[model samples]
Target: MVTSVLAGFAASAVLIVAIGAQNAFVLRQGLRREHVLAVVAICAVSDLVLILAGIGGLGAVVSARPGAVTAIRWIGAAFLVSYAIMAARRAARPSTLNPAERTPTTLGATLITCLALTYLNPHVYLDTVLLLGSIAQQHPHRWLFGIGAAAASLVWFAALGAGAHKLGPLLARPAAWRVLDGVIALVMLGVAVNLATG
Candidate 1:
């Protein structure tokens, strides 16, 4: 039982620790200190729901629908591309990239963007729902595995969102923010292209 839980945690950590859209967004929000708790909560909760759904047999259902996945891919690619363009614009304008100088986004808008970034990424479904879910079934205690996976998600997001502020001193300058935004834009565009082409 303990082994199953550990297995789940390790599997989830491997998938969640990547430099993905979700992670990037979380890091950015954490650095800005905007809705950090809310963002982390939403991400962790969403992962829990999706992981459970997968373990509950939703993965099989989703896997059987190739068309749906394709639709999600295209939609996700479009959203990501749009986001990349916005990031690029921010990077180009170093003044606007500075968190201290920029206007704070509303809670509603932040939440909306968070949700869109989380849900619009087809990789989230593939990794959390399908991949993790399928792996959980291999364990003798599948539910335990789900719990472990959920725990990993919660821990990772919490750490990422909470720990990001430590870099506040480093990102204090507009040049640093511009570089960060540039990296973000590139990451977004890379993911978008992968989704569109893959």
Candidate 2:
């Protein structure tokens, strides 16, 4: 059981630690200190649901539906491309990148974007639902493995969102924000391209 849990945690941490749209957004929210807790909760909860579904064998069902996967891929790519464009615009205009000067987004809007970024990314389904689910089935204590995976998701998101404040001073400058936004735009575009082409 211990080995199973550890395996699950390791697998999940490997996947979640990667820099992606969800992580980037969470970090930004953390830096701004706006709706940080809510964003982290939503991300963690969503991952839990996905991991559960995967462990419950929904991964097989999803895999059987190529058309559904294709549809999600295209939709996710489109959404990501649009978001990348917005980020690029922000990067171009450093004036709007200042957290102090920029107006805080409403909680409702922030949550909605968070959900979209979480769900619309087909990679989330692939990694959490299909890959993790398939891996969990290998353990005698599959449920324990699932629990461990969920725990990892919670820990990762919480740390990312909470720890972002440590870099607040570094990002206080407009130049730093522009660099950050530029990186975000590139990451989003790269992901979008991968989704569309892969």
Candidate 3:
């Protein structure tokens, strides 16, 4: 059972680690040092809610409605492609930030942005609630799996946000941002292509 729970958590983390808008936003905010804790907490909580909902039978309902998932897949693919373009554009003109501006401190604004990024992204529900939840349900003590998955989200968000802060100097460089954004664009484009093809 413990092994199953750990496997569920690992699987959940792998899925969530994709280069989507939310992860991009989190990394960017972390680099900017803007409301890291708030953003992390919001992401963690959102995942918790969605994972629980999925484990509690929402995944089954979603699976029953193939149309909804299909629609979301297309929409998400479009969003990812758009985001990729934006990142590629940014790569061309990376902006260097002042050290003073890179302090993650905005509370309300960060919370709102994190909320919008997490909730508005339909892919979050499809992946976290539907895919992860459904897979977890197959294990005994499904609740344990849910807990482990939720813990993964919390750990990931916190680590990504806080850890990026330590790399402020490197991230502040135009060259570094360009490289990062370029990588982001490629990852997102790959995901989009996979979505369209799959």
lDDT of each: 0.92, 0.93, 0.79
Model 3 per-residue lDDT tens digits across residues 1-198: 898779778988898776677887788778777777778888998899999999898978887898877777777678678878977897777467543354454687667656755765667877898888878878888888888899899988888988887877776666787888888788778767777776
Off by over 4 Å in 2: none
Clashing pairs in 3: 33-103, 33-104, 34-104, 35-104, 35-105
Model 1 / residue 139 / CA error / Å:
0.4
**Candidate 3: lDDT of 128?**
92
Clash pairs detected, candidate 1: none
Residue 34 shift from truth in candidate 3, angstroms: 1.4
Candidates sorted by lDDT, best first: 2, 1, 3
**TM-score for each predicted model, relative to the true structure:** 0.97, 0.97, 0.78
Candidate 3 vs. truth: CA RMSD? 3.3
Model 1 lDDT tens row, 56-103:
999999899999999999999999999999989988874834674578
Pairs with backbone N, CA or C atoms under 3 Å apart (clashes), candidate 2 = none
- The root-mean-square deviation over C-alpha atoms between each candidate and the true structure, in angstroms, is 1.1, 1.1, 3.3
lDDT of 2 by residue, 112-165 (tens): 989989999999999999999999999999988988999999999999999999
Q: What's the distance in Å from true for residue 26, model 2? A: 0.4
- Which parts of model 1 are misplaced by more than 4 Å? none
